[model samples]
Target chain A: MITPSPALPIAVPLVAAAFLAGLRKFLRRWLADLIATATAAANLWLCTALLRASWHSNIVYWFGNWFPRGRMVVGIGFEVDPVGAGLATLACLLTLLGFIYSWRITDSGRDLFQPLMLIFMAAMCGFAMTADLFNLFVFFELMSTAAFALCGLKTHEPAPLQGAFNFAVTNTVGAFLILTGIALVYAVTGALNMAQIGFLLGSRHDLLVIAAAAFLCSGFLIKAAIAPFHFWLPDAHSVAPTPVCVLFSGLMVELGAFAVLRMTSVMFGQSLLQPHSAFRATLLLLGSLTVVWGGLMCFAEHHLKRVLAFSTISHGGAMLLGVAIGTPAAITGWLTYLFAHAMAKAGLFFTAGILLHRLQSMSEPQLFKRGRPLRFTAVLWLLGGIALAALPPFGLSNGEDLIESATHAHAIHLWVTLMFFFTSAMTGAAVFRVGMRVFFGLGDAGPADRAAKIDEAPDGPEEQHHIPARMFLPAALCIALSAAPAYIPGFGRWFFNAAHRFLAQSLYIARIYAQPVHYVLPPAPHSDLGSTLMHGAIAVVCALLLASWAVFHLALPRGFRGATHLEGPMFPLRKLQSGHPGDYVVWCMVGFVLLGGCLFLLP
Target chain B: MNQIVHIFPYLVAGWVFLCGLYGIATSRHLVHTVISLAVVQTSTYVLLLNIGFRTGGAAPVFADISPGITTVDPIVQALMLTDVVVEATVMALLLAMVVKAYEKAGTLSPDDLRLMRG
Candidate 1:
């Protein structure tokens, strides 16, 4: 059997996307969707195959056979290690699930949707696989462009237009920063391939290198929606179509985390891995802030999609925390959490989409009890909330266990745990509040469950029966897969091995420079009942606190003293977002300057 | 003279980039914001070309040029072309969105587009 080229994962969808673009005008709707669906499914299979093929060693495929001549890398290479392959598989799997969920959506530009989606998938694959820094920037732009078009697909709505405009402006600035940083790196080292650059700059602490690190990381930090740079995400996620939101929150941001990790390790890992490094501490501080901010704002958010968006921010925080810790266990926790969040968040959004489709508005107060008697969706929502809270029956708990252990092992125990619990509970309370008000209708000042609004009929028997099978299918698949770390015995072992390879810079450096085929694997990962139980105990405490507010109505929102000023600090930050492209642009500039200063003065 | 020559482009690029950032911060209209974004993009072009510059170097194409004459790096030029294309595409899309948003809301001011809140 002929070995498939490493480029096929990217080439397949790109070729399919070109055909889909041409076919969009001539073909019927279902045929177009069928082609798109089949392509997405095939892409998923290809990604899995690539992962399996590259499981034992990294796969480095040079374009036009431009392998390194002696010491020089003459051409672009797509280097797919186990970690990159794992992330690529994730991007493909989520895109497949998104396409499945979008099967029922037949809007006017439905045809445009399929091609844009295909392009997005291809670019995501390219971004994950490419070893060239400049090529990574190209793929980043392609991915952002496709996503921008998709965000503005519903052109009839003013909100989507505004949201897409803000998203474009902010992300374009980020792309510029990344480009400039890449250029600086090239100027310093005369190489664009990541491993070559790492080898050239190994353990060096040049001022220019520090500036490049700041520039590169700031760009990705915005992309990953780290705090203060996260203003674009809630607007973009809330206004984008449901399936698009799934990719935005689920796959794209996680990919951003992966990018940041990749840049740090490959570019400056030798110099900046110390405990007192400013880079490490800054990441941890920013991550903690994001967790706190996203958690608090989620509870306060009135719009259902907005609530989910804030939850994405909070989860991004947890992932960032794990990344900043930079342990095998922490990274393993991060990857596992990325998986769990993708599923639970997508499922939650899918359930919320059903509500929005049935009821025109996404306002939580307005949607109260409108989803009544939809027992299956309600149950899914409840379980998704539990998993999101890192309570039970999902790999999120396992991920939480890994991250907590990493914190303690690093000896930063007390504050990290407290912050983790605080943030998780805040967002978890927000989700459960939606569960209480919308699904179960338990939190009412009065006993009135009567038909409140006319545009939305009461959730009668007809409504329950009318739920689309396709709509529920994707959510079910996601939820089931999210629970993998819990039920699958070897899930932790698989991640331990992957993380061991992923975190080892010399392994990557050697793969490119020397092509070492043999390697030693990390020890087999097993579950820690002790850590899991500790996490569960922490979650139970959070659940009880949330129960006081959500279930028993104790510490009632209106009854508390100084209730009016509760969001005092948040109000200023909210004002800063401003929904204006201009303000967002200014923030990006400030962020760039701040990043440079911080990196230049790193201890 | 040599130091000034090397430093001039860097200073100009930084100045232009900062001006563009300031324009975005202070602009009232979406058109102005888009224009400012183009200016920011121009700074990148300057930086790229400056990095590729070699004193007295001719254009990289050498089909008809005499032997032993140095040429500026062509790769940076290629990267600049890509940057310009991406900038143009983003500007056109942003302009289109601005037009649509104006049609829908009957205004172009950011202050007026206040439908969403925390």
Candidate 2:
């Protein structure tokens, strides 16, 4: 499975897509699905190989074996660090799951769907591993194009077109800003390879450099669904077919965070030396805002998919916060959170898909008492919610344990701790609210709502009893995968070391300059009994709060929707999510301006 | 003065980029907004081309160049070419999406598409 070069992961799927496309004219449906699975599996295997090769050092693959000119890296290269390999592998694994989740739906366009997913997978992995800035742009665009089409896949449905249009417009705008930024970076160095550009930059604190960095990150901020640039995410996720949502919510948005971290650490490493304080403060503010805003929105949202989308934003915020901390521990926590959230969120979305397929409605009130009988899915949903809530034994909590330690170490403990607790509680409570209301009919029957009575379950008891294996199986497997990591011996320590090495910019730069890294394996997790207990207590308390809220919901007065009062107080913030493309564009431009000012004027 | 001249195109690119954003924020129709997006995308073309420009440089064509003549940055031009292609493709995709939205919603104004909300 391991190859001599890092490019194998990218090349396999890129080639396989063309191969699949050629065979598409004559191939049957299952055959196309099989090819897609094979291709995804191979890419996954190669990613493991790449991770193995890059454990200690960076592996740079030059195109056509182009030799460097003296100290300059004249040729474009594909650099695979362990973090990159991990992310690349995550994309492959998610694609494989997404493919399997939809295997039973072999309609006429199934061939097209599988190939697009493959290309999307290729572009994502390619972006994760590429060393050249321009090539990164290319891969990003390819990924976005595939995502846009996939969002619009259900074209006959009125909502999807609207969603995809907003997605395309906002993302295209972000893309242009980043392209301009890349051109400016190239302007300064005449170098496309990121390491060479870093060397050329050499600690320059010029205005152009600041602008380029801001612009570069602004685009990714949009992609990451960071607040103010996050308008399109909910719409897109709500309308896109659920399988695609798994990829979009789980991996695609995370790539945006990956991009921001990559550019800062690898390309702008020197520029950050002087402006570190200002940069850190700005990012911390933005990250906190994203978490708070996203959590509050998720708490208020009623639509199931939209609620999940908001949760993704909130988790993205947490991930961004971890990256903004920019410590080895923080990065370690981010990796853990990213891995766990992807698995749990994907599973949650699959369950939502099943809700749509079986009940034909996405409304929470509509599904009340309808899903009551499906105890297995209800348990899966709650378990996933608990994992998402960062329960003590879950991977998310372990990530939180590491991150809260980072905050304490960095002396931002009080603010980050409060925000982290609030955000997680709110998001967890939102999911808890939905699970109880829809699955168990815990809430009051409000005004005898029409949606409450419109259950469209299959007529016969036998048919009603039938659960789609495709949906339930994938959900269970993904949830189990996410949960397994938390208890896996040494997983945390392994992740910690990978992250430490990832944050070691000078080492990465040296490796790119073809220097040996002298890799050292980090010691496995040890007892920090006090901090572990504290974090566990916080998680347990949050879980307790959610549980009590559900119990209290069951005790509430009839015909009352209790939380409508919560939004009344936050009307201004609610209005901020205007759902207009123009408004979203304004937010992005404003965010870009703020980002530039933060870089140029602050500190 | 010479430095300002050298930096002139980037200043223009910034202005054009802001204008495009302004247009998108104010525009009523989706088609017009996408065109404004295209205009913003054009700023990147200018930026890349200007970045690669030399004061007294020849093209990167090898046949007619003398031994030590400075050629403008060919790599950036290559980058710009790729950018144009991507721009074209994205525009096509956006326009297609616009058409679909128009057909389905019977409206091209973004203000009317406020269905999803917090």
lDDT (tens digit, per residue) of candidate 1 on A378-495: 8888777777877766778788778877766456777677766776677777777778778777755211111111122111223334667888898888878888888877788778
TM-score, prediction 1? 0.94
Each candidate's B-chain TM-score, in sequence, is 0.93, 0.93
The interface RMSD for candidate 1 is: 5.3
Measured as a fraction from 0 to 1, the native contacts recovered by model 2 come to: 0.70
Which pairs clash (backbone N, Cα, C closer than 3 Å) in model 1? none
Report the C-alpha lDDT of model 2 over A1-603, residue by residue, as the tens digit. 445577777778888888888888898878888888889988888888888888756777888888577778877788888899999998999898888877746242345788788889999999999988999999999999999988877766567777778788899888988898898888778788887787788888788888889889999999999987898898888777777899999999999999998888888877874434677777888888899889887766667888799899988988888888887787888898899889999989988877776676766766777888788889888887877787666677777767777777456877777766766677777777778777887754222221122222211122234666877888998888776665788787778878887766677677777776666655544435466556656755675565445435546565553555442334356677766787888888888888889878887
Q: What is the TM-score of chain B in candidate 2?
A: 0.93
- Which stretches in model 1 have alpha-carbon errors above 4 Å? A1-3, A106-108, A445-465, A524-527, A547-572, B65-68
Where does the lowest 10-residue lDDT sum fall in candidate 2 chain A? Answer: A451-460
Top candidate (DockQ): 2
